[model samples]
Target: MTTRAGDRSDGTTVWATPAWRERATAWADDELAAQGVRRTGAVEQPHLRPWSTVLRLPTSAGSVWLKAPGPGLASEVGLYPVLARWAPEHVLVPYAVDAERRWLLLPDGGEVLGRRLTPEAADRWHLALAGYARLQQRVSRAADLLVAAGAPDHRPQRLTALLEEVADDAAAVTVTDEEREVVARARRERGRVEELAGVLADDGTPPTVQHDDLHRDNVFAHGPRVFDWGDAVVAHPYASLLVALRDTAAPYGVGLEDPRVLAARDAYLAPYGGPTAATLRVVEAARTVGILSRTASWLRALAPLPPHEAADVREAPYRWLAMLADGESL
Candidate 1:
């Protein structure tokens, strides 16, 4: 059965339903028990969306988090073991994973980065991105295995094809006439999209695992370990900067050109060769293509939801596509 957020048109609601919660709770308890841990209090549902939901279990050991993803994100269940093996120092390997149920039991990774950028947090940001880049470099060697394990394949060369697929799905992008025009214009710019992808591919930084939604909240403050791999993809490594720099800097009222943002960018690029003009151009191109990668990921997340259930965020993919209509960096 497909798990959706709150769609009960079929006379059933999967997420948050009594039976679903019971099963998830039983599984989480079993997983905890296997590790010699016992729950000390009631489970709490902290986050719920069309794509996934999270449960917080207070335990003898501390707090363990249980994540149950919607049908669209079932791959994330399988990616945890792979990430744990590849970047053990940079991620919390799940305590237990139930791939068939699309659930993961993870230990409470420490505090997350502060919402706003402070002087003290700047170094942590730099360290997080730098460490993440190193992890990407290592993952590049096993890029194929990443895709095999369920990370979306967003390689530079494949971006235009992804765009083409989304564009043809008019139902997915067209909410208004203007949005339709946005899709039409994006389709015509297919060549430009392919050209940018080529630039990124030729830049010599091999495609690797990119946390398409990498930002402050996703990185723990301790190891500064990165988590939340549901939005991950195999893409140009620099493509990650789109979210790391732009999204991270936004809450602080800074743009990518801001010194702090630039510092973090340089930190990540250091492993790839620092921020020379050539590398910066590659960064810009990667950012441009990264918008589509975000779009593709959103499309996947939104695919299995009923129209009403997806209503609030359904415009996301087209909105990202609209950024490309002006041929500007997103």
Candidate 2:
């Protein structure tokens, strides 16, 4: 039998191994029986990547998903109970979590939002953004709990040091001379990150769970449930918009400044202050410095990836950090 841990000498992830699958299958069977849900068909391994793996189990009730993250991303398993407690309406409470193994068994979260760009899609974006904003507001009070449960804390006050750390790390900034220059500029202007942090703090919106990635596919169509917390961080809530607006608008051939995008932005901002000039300023600042949080998330996930596989993906952290040099491009 294959070993239960460690990648293959050839650099394959362990989750693809029969030994790991056997352990996961046994655990899943026990969990399902406890819930009185019997398996009705063969289990399917639908997603397996360097950072995580997802197994789809057919059962009496319906299909349930089992996700196991690589060690670097294990915190995602511990986060669901906290999210369920704080924003039950917006995210699912996992059926069970194996804290030791970092695995989560979750109910089917319904259809993902459509990828097509349409007026209807914009409406869905508006609701998803607004609903996610509410989730952030609700989850704000659980910051300490979330941190204890392993969510990375990228709170506003910590931005300056985090900025310096990422900008100075050679491993994170190994790309281009232009990116090098951007990193240098970012280091010199580290004070600006501190200033932005102060502005956001004064705005009275407490730092909450920032889904470092919030796009159409991450949210659901049948309801407001948002999944994929592996990249989540506890930071200035508005920081989430950097990814939300950019990714959602890209497929539609629109930018963040588009009318549809602005409406969606306002929808998200409604919970905070509804796009007032001051709020917009705060948001722009958050989205700018939030780039570091994005870089940090990528670095965390990329840490354990095989060097050969991560050569291209490794450029992401530096690329995002370079955005700090470009002012308010969000």
Candidate 3:
């Protein structure tokens, strides 16, 4: 079961229901007609993304994927052309976009990588990492353009400021005892986090585009196309690995120290240069900062939840903050 409609971090209460279907129907119809598709109905893809609504519309030729950004967010339509200029093959460029309504239509990119990850997993992950590295390098030159297109400024320099702001918000909200504890723990470790953030910023690392959420499912298996640019950022390129390294490792029953995992990480870093112990140090701190930013964003989402829905939403983030702040390795 999914989080109740009222508990969703995104403000929209309309999702996976008739209401959401009705609103998206018009967009689907328009895009289908433009694509010369002679279909009368569309189906909602059974996906659990909390950020947007995706509809799979069948056509005489192929399927068309239509997406509408969730409540109070900018449309990612602008990002396609920017990515195309640098890494066209790695992203699915939309055919038509309605900027005002936060809607876009894209050609179906076939199955997601997660479905077939168990076989040739190493090779697939290496391909993904290498392609992603190229995307980062090319996009670095266009950082300003990407940021204007809705990517957040996720550089390490901004982490502490964002943390403090979220901490204060949590302290002021009085929403739940659980959330307050997360904020309390964050505040307790604020000094150490700030110092590390400074080092990350001072490393003089060439900042590049980061796909903040690069979980396997967001990638296509064969084409190795990347989807879901909603969490894209402009940060040190290695920061991408900090997030991906931890994400891809644990699920496969491998630790960060595992040689196999470290090899793939080396592959990701290969685009920039050979692996070095210094880069490893920055990445170690970056992982914590990334988690801190994510936890703060979650708390922001949790701010509006009612008392009844608060408990279910607050536990994991709270526990993570406590563990990370207390110097426990995740």
Best by lDDT: 1
* Stretches of candidate 2 exceeding 4 Å from the true structure: 1-12, 170-179
Residue range 250-313, candidate 3, lDDT tens digits: 6767788887678778888787675788877887777777766555545544554555545565
lDDT of 2 by residue, 261-294 (tens): 7888899998876989998988988898889888
Q: Model 2 TM-score?
A: 0.93
Local distance difference test, candidate 2:
0.82
Give the distance in Å from residue 34's predicted Cα in candidate 1 to where it truly belongs.
1.8
TM-score of each: 0.93, 0.93, 0.83
lDDT at position 108, candidate 2: 90
* Candidate 2: worst-modelled 10 consecutive residues by lDDT: 1-10
- Best first by lDDT, ranked: 1, 2, 3
- The TM-score obtained by model 1 is 0.93
Q: What lDDT is reached at residue 107 by model 2?
A: 89
Off-target runs (Cα >4 Å) in candidate 1 are: 1-12, 170-173
lDDT by residue for model 1 over 53-165, one digit each (tens)? 88899999999999988766677887889888888898888999988778899999989986655777888888888999999988788888889988878898798897887
